[model samples]
Target: MAEARQLREYVPAEVPESAAPATIEDGDLTGGATDHTVWSCAGNLTAVRSVRARVRDFLARMGHSETVLDDAELAVSELATNALLHSRSGQSGGVMTLFIRSDGTRLRVAVADQGERAGEGGHSREDGDDFGRGKLIVDSCATRSGEYWSEATHVAWFEIEDPRPGLSLADTAL
Candidate 1:
């Protein structure tokens, strides 16, 4: 007889400290180059790749420098990966949503998942092993990043402060 193995899910360690959780409200993006777009896809293992690609393309088209574009892509990927691993969104028939907002000076990317994860034996961060713990990368590179939950979804997001607003790397003199 074949043995069935339990899936091991990974959740990232919490950020050391930040402001207390509060209401999630969208602020104004009052800048010349302002835009907001959202995308949704099946929240499975494959979402990490697709989400990263979309975010990269979206930011590229927004005329952001390569540094910001790369950092935003990495940050978004980290957030998405976390949402998938830690929430029910990673389960079958689940879905994940990506929210992006930019004001030519700063860009914010958010990933919304179904909710907290529940599995036979999925939560394991005490082993001292590392595979899915990368949320810190987001916190390190992003200018401002945090997470909040709506009634139905667990959302994590980060904001990048662009050093050169409205400038694309394509026209750089370097």
Candidate 2:
């Protein structure tokens, strides 16, 4: 596991409102409850796995459905990987921040990374296949998704609403 950076003073962030059902109220997804967390994620593959496992556990403890758990894990993995592969965060001593918030009904995840490196990014292995499909997977799974930049930080975020109990995720999508 990579060493996380020392914590910084906490400042709540807001994503622009969208058509999504759940919103982060001043970054409090639990509505004064207690389901929000921030992680100082090191830009590395190990952190990717840890982030996925942590997210799965977090949502699971909140009683989210398995499908929703799977989707959230997948989406976070992609965002973290993008930070590792496409931005300066993957460079030496680089770190990214992960924000997670959820109530029983809705969950939001975002990764903030140092913006793109000068002229260095991309995989060496390519055979005409899409090298990066992070956004595509997020688009399919999230109720709303978007990316933005603040200064030199790039933030990618996604939100999902749980399928009503007794309903499948596919059912809700329809």
Candidate 1, residues 98-135: lDDT per residue as tens digits? 76767667787777666786653445568666754566
Clashes of 1: 0
- Give the per-residue lDDT of model 2 (tens digit) for 1-174: 142332112222455455223433445465612333445444567889887888888778777788888889999999988887788778776677777777678888888777787796555346475675678899898888877776567778888888563355676789
C-alpha lDDT score of every prediction, in listed order: 0.64, 0.70
- Top model number, TM-score: 2
lDDT score for residue 153 of model 1: 65
Residue pairs with clashing backbones, model 1: none
Candidate 1 worst ten-residue window by lDDT: 1-10
Which segments of candidate 2 are over 4 A away from where they belong? 1-12, 16-43, 121-129, 163-174
Go through the candidates in order and give the C-alpha RMSD of each one to the true structure: 8.8, 5.5
lDDT of 2: 0.70
Task: Give lDDT for model 1.
Answer: 0.64
